[model samples]
Target chain A: MLRRKQFWFAIMAILPTFAIFGWVRLFPIIETLRLSMHEWNLLSKNKPFVGFQNFIELFSDNQFMDALTNTAVIAFGAMAVTIPMSMVLAAIIYHRTRSRFSGFYETAVFIPHVVSLVPAAMAWKWIFDAKLGPLNAIIMGLGGDALPWLFDPVLSVICIIFLVSWQTLGYGVLIYLVGFRNLPKSVFEAAQLDGANGFQSFLYMSVPLLKPITLYVSVVTLISGFNVYAQAYVLASDTQGAPGRQVRVLVLDMLENSFQNFRVGYAAAEAVILLSIVLLLTMIQFGLLRGKGGR
Target chain B: MSAKARARRTNFLLDVTLFVICILLLTPLILLIANGFKTPQEMLVWPPTLFPKDPTLENFHKVFTETPLLQWMLNSFLFALLSTVAIVATSALAGYIVGKFPFRAINIIFILFLATAIIPFEVYMIPLYFQVKALGLLNSVGGLLVGYLVMSFGIFLIRQNVIASIPDELLEAARIDGAGELWIFWYVVLPLLRGPLAALAVLAFFQAWTAFAWPIIVMTRKKSFTIEVGLANFQSAYTVDLSLLSAASAAVMVPSVLAFVLLRRNFVEGIAASGMKE
Candidate 1:
């Protein structure tokens, strides 16, 4: 009876957390899946069940396809540049510096990560603002014509990618620095005895050994990239992914459908799709990590 | 040249390069702060001066007097404080039971927590909004707080920390001394969990502080707006007031940035732990 009581007590201890998760998180997720199959706006009295119609419309819809592609481009594009650049930066800071200023370097790089995204986006918007913006002023001073940073379709996408990379680069560098710090010093010493130059050793040994950290960073970045909303929303001035929807990521697209257009069913379908992609990437990350014998 | 001389030259070059990169990375932030002090006329100058020609405190004064900046800051603080405390308390209790206790349903419960961490907010955002609205939480701070309370990440973080740090022998000794489970948990486990709990608090506080999308959906009233949402509205409302916008952004960013600088080590460790661990 005492043992049974202990078990019940343990269950009771954890029940509040489970209740919160079930009601707020798990139930909403399941409800999202359910809502994806029905046609219901916020004002609608009746949610008519329309099986697979929303999902079917998603593929045929041009805006959804654009948002999907934009998400991929931004996520993949940002990660591609951010991972390698951060690795190189981390290597420089970790391998080269033996002074006290290294701490300053890490903190400087990390400031962006700690700041709120909305403010950072506001700062970026100011930097990218035309006419009276500082960036264009510099270009005009240099005798170059003022280029549209956020107004052009291609440039808007580039600006979004740049903003994401700028915010995330510091995080990548810090993680890679941890990875570098954890590496065995003896291996580098041995490599030095073999006459391996700094460049050669870094290219062959440091890069390969840091594969797990790289994959981990890439996956985290990838997930955040797909969920990119606030930055685009803040920077674009027009929240509907301005410049002909060139930078409209999945989240923004879903928001527009649900709140602006009142297509809650269609937005739920978009949400379900994003959820699948996130789950798939998560699975791939686990598989890769497990193949490397687990962290 | 001698090997030592060559090495010295290389190190000097690397230092210069890293210094330049640091400056470049910090320039935008520096500009943000610098422009906050400039007058509106100075902000409009072509090939804008790096330093304000005439720096003034009027913009900051105007932001406080003209806008609901303080109320928004208080709202943000309340949200962050309540969310952090709740997350730390619930995560510690649930994590202790899940991490230390050997119960039959523990694995399923732990898995459920981990599963929620993988699903990004965007995925269930619409449904969550509707759910909160149905509960009459829309446009209310309590409603805003409810969504943040389901912190699976915090639970996992605390659970991992407990499993790794706390020893079973200690709990066993307490049990042998006739200490009740709740008593042992209160006096022993909670005290030992101070380090991880502090780290989790920093993480949760920052997460709640910087939250944008959810607060935008729920906090429709001006009085209920968090600092971040208020900053966004301030931008749209005063589009031509560059000085005011810069000042507002700086004001909104100060708290989180200050917290990070103060708890630098814990913030980095917590962030690294979240990413590196499964």
Candidate 2:
């Protein structure tokens, strides 16, 4: 009787969490998948099964094509910048672990990660402002032509990539620092005793050992990079006179389709694609983790 | 002169280089606060100044008076506070059972919680929005709080902490002494979990506080906007007054940054703990 009562207690205790998670997190993905296959503008009661018709239409959609290409570029681009840069920064901080300034350094790098995203992106926007911004001011002062950072087609995407990297860099560094701290110290000691310099040891030992960390950080960064909406929106959304060419990204595209154009079914299809990409990336992460453990 | 001296010299150089890089990294944030104090005329001046020529609180006053900045802040605070408390409670309750209970089905429950972390929010936000709408929760605090009330990461973190820290014998002892399970959890398990719970609370609060994408979609009205959404909207409304926009951004950033700096250890440890688990 006591055992049965304990079991029931556990079930009752966990049921609320299970309910909330299922309703909010799990149910939505299933519903989104289901919604992607039907045509409804979020208003009409008459819904028709489109059966991959929306996906077919999205393949030839020019705006989605641009959004896809830009999003892929930005995702890969941000990952490219963040991974190596943060690893190196973490290596430096790890080596200086005994320094009194280590805490200060970590906090300084991490402040950006915690700051509200819109404000941080706005700060970047002001810096990258075409005519009146400080970036142009510096360039012109240094005898280089003032490039339109946000206005130009290619430059604008690069601007978004930079913003993504700037925000994610702090997080990447923090994770890598943790990775460094967890690394076995004897390998470094062995390398040093064999007369390896700091750079050599870091290049060979730290790099290979932290391969899992690098993969984890890159996947996380790329996932967030794929979800890049607010940075791109705040940077280049349509303004009155001097609007930069709006960088069509995946999330922004979905929002426009769903909310603005009332193409709920079509946006749901786009979301399904985004979901597939994220799910694939997550699978890779899990596969690697399991593989590492099995070995 | 000596090997140790040479190594010390190299270390010194590295520290200086790292310091310079840190400053470079912090410059944009510094500019965010610095530019907020500039007068409008100074803001529009050719070859814009980094620091304000004549700093004033005029722009901050304008942000408060001209916009619904207080309402936005209040909304963000309530959203963060309420969601953080709910997530902590639910995660702790679930994590305690999943971590400590030896039921045959416990593994499945734990795995189900872990699985939710894999799906990104954007993929399902459409359906979530629809669900909220179906429940008639659109443009309300309940709508905003609905999606954030249960965090998969929080559940995982608390479970990990419980398993690693709280030995089952203590709970068993309490049980043998005729204490109810919930009573033991409240008195014994919770005190042991104070560290991770604090860490989870800090993380959850930050996530709720700085949340932009979902909140922006849910709260469309100007009066219900979170600080992030409000700050984004400030750009269009105060386009001509750059100082006012900067002031708004700075104000929104202050609380999170201050909390982070004050609780720096818990914040960093919480993040590190999450990353390390993955």
Candidate 3:
């Protein structure tokens, strides 16, 4: 009798939430799935669902291929650099410092992780601007010729990478710091008494021990790299992959189709494809982390 | 040197090096603030000044006068505040529901929520836009508010906090007290969930405030524009006004920074929590 009543109450609470979830998130996902089969603009009144044509077109689109390649390279690059750097930062911050300044340094570094993306991108844009930009200024000051940051095909991607990560190192450092803080200090002390030196103590004890957090950080970093947008939009003003379509990433493709082109069906197809890639890669990363980490 | 003295000296060196690196990390923000006060002409010099040489409020005045900054700030605050409130309220109750219930389906549902966070908002951008449009919510504040609420990350973030803090014994005991699940949640669970609730709320508020992409699609009108869109006005096909842009840039960041600093502990903890968890 009591069980039934409690379940009823729980259902009551979850009901409005369910409607909200259905109406807002879940319905749109289903709608997108349906719309991906059609080839109609949102502005059109009479729409015919041409099943799988949009996806087929996306498969053939060379621009889609370019966006995929750029996204892959950038996401993979971020993971490769940030993962090891974060581990090193965590190991060093744990074993290296004992001063009151560590706290101040941590706080200072963490501020960027919280700064709004608009200013962050704008600041990076100024720093990297080709003419009259500080980047050129620094290069010229060093008695070297200036290389274009946002204009060149190669350096533009680098600029995207740099802008996204200006403070993400702080993100990695801070989180790994917490996971480090939560470690039982006695483990390191135990390692020390066993004739373990500095690098050995970190490698033999700390690195092996911080497995859960390391996996967490890598997963987050990979996902965050995929979420890179505000920089490209704000700095480049959706003009990335400029100087010959070199930097148009997946999100940029989606935004261009949906916003600029207003081809809602075609855009939905790109989005669905992106969601699959992200989901698959994320799972693979986690599965590999589990397999190697001895978790 | 003595062994203790050598350790102290080494630690001091590391701190100095770390401080230098920290300064490098913050170089962008320092540049923004530094250039914000410069006259537009001074800003275009060969090498940017470390400090504004001819400090002027002209750009700041231009930013304040020409841009819809004050309104944008208010809109961002309200949007963020509502998001925080909705997240705290919904996630607290929902987290309790998942925590207290022993149903096998709950974990799957929780996992479903968590898994959604991994999917980028880019995936949902197109369809969700027209969804809002169908509800007749384009160019409206209510549209932005609801759009922010359906966020996977906020619920996912709050759920992690809830799952971490709520113990099984506490929930079971409330059940044994002839208290309803809602009763236990209202009186017992919410108080304990305050730390992470506060954490998620602060983060959600910032996320809502710094929201650039969603506002672009939703708020199409000039009067309805948020701080981010207003800041984007500095650039166009013809000219890039660097100084006024910096001032406008400063305007966009200040509210968010102030909000984070006011809730600094929770902000850091929330970020740490998110990174540590998933």
Clash list (residue pairs), candidate 3 = A241-A246, A241-A247
C-alpha displacement of B15 in model 1, angstroms? 2.5
In angstroms, the error of model 3 at A137 is 1.7
In the range B1-278, model 1's lDDT, one tens digit per residue, is 99999998988888888889988887887888888999999987887777898889999899899999999999999999999988988899998888977777977898888878889987887898988898898987788898788588788888888889889899878888999999988999999888878888988899999898889888989889999888887766666688898888887777667778889888888888876574
What local distance difference test score does each model get? 0.86, 0.88, 0.74
Better of 1 and 3 by TM-score: 1
10 residues in a row with least lDDT, candidate 1 chain A: A237-246
Of the candidates numbered 2 and 3, which has the greater TM-score value?
A: 2
Candidate 3 local lDDT, residue B98: 59
Clash numbers, per candidate:
0, 0, 2
The numbered model that scores best in lDDT is 2
For candidate 3, write residues B151-177 as lDDT tens digits. Answer: 555566656666777777877687787
**TM-score winner between candidates 1 and 2:** 2
Ten residues in sequence with the least summed lDDT for candidate 3 chain A: A237-246
How close is chain B to the truth by TM-score, in each candidate? Answer: 0.95, 0.96, 0.89
Query: lDDT tens string, model 1, A1-295?
Result: 7678678888999998888889888998999999999998889699999999999999999989988998899999899989998999999999665866888888888988888988898888878887667888888889999988877767878888998999899999999998999889999999999999999999999998988899989998999999988887788764322334336789878988998999999899999999999999989988998998874
Report the number of the highest-DockQ candidate: 2
Superposition error at A124 for model 2 (Å): 1.0
Of models 2 and 3, which has the larger lDDT? 2
C-alpha positional error of residue B109 in candidate 2 after TM-score superposition, expressed in Å: 2.9
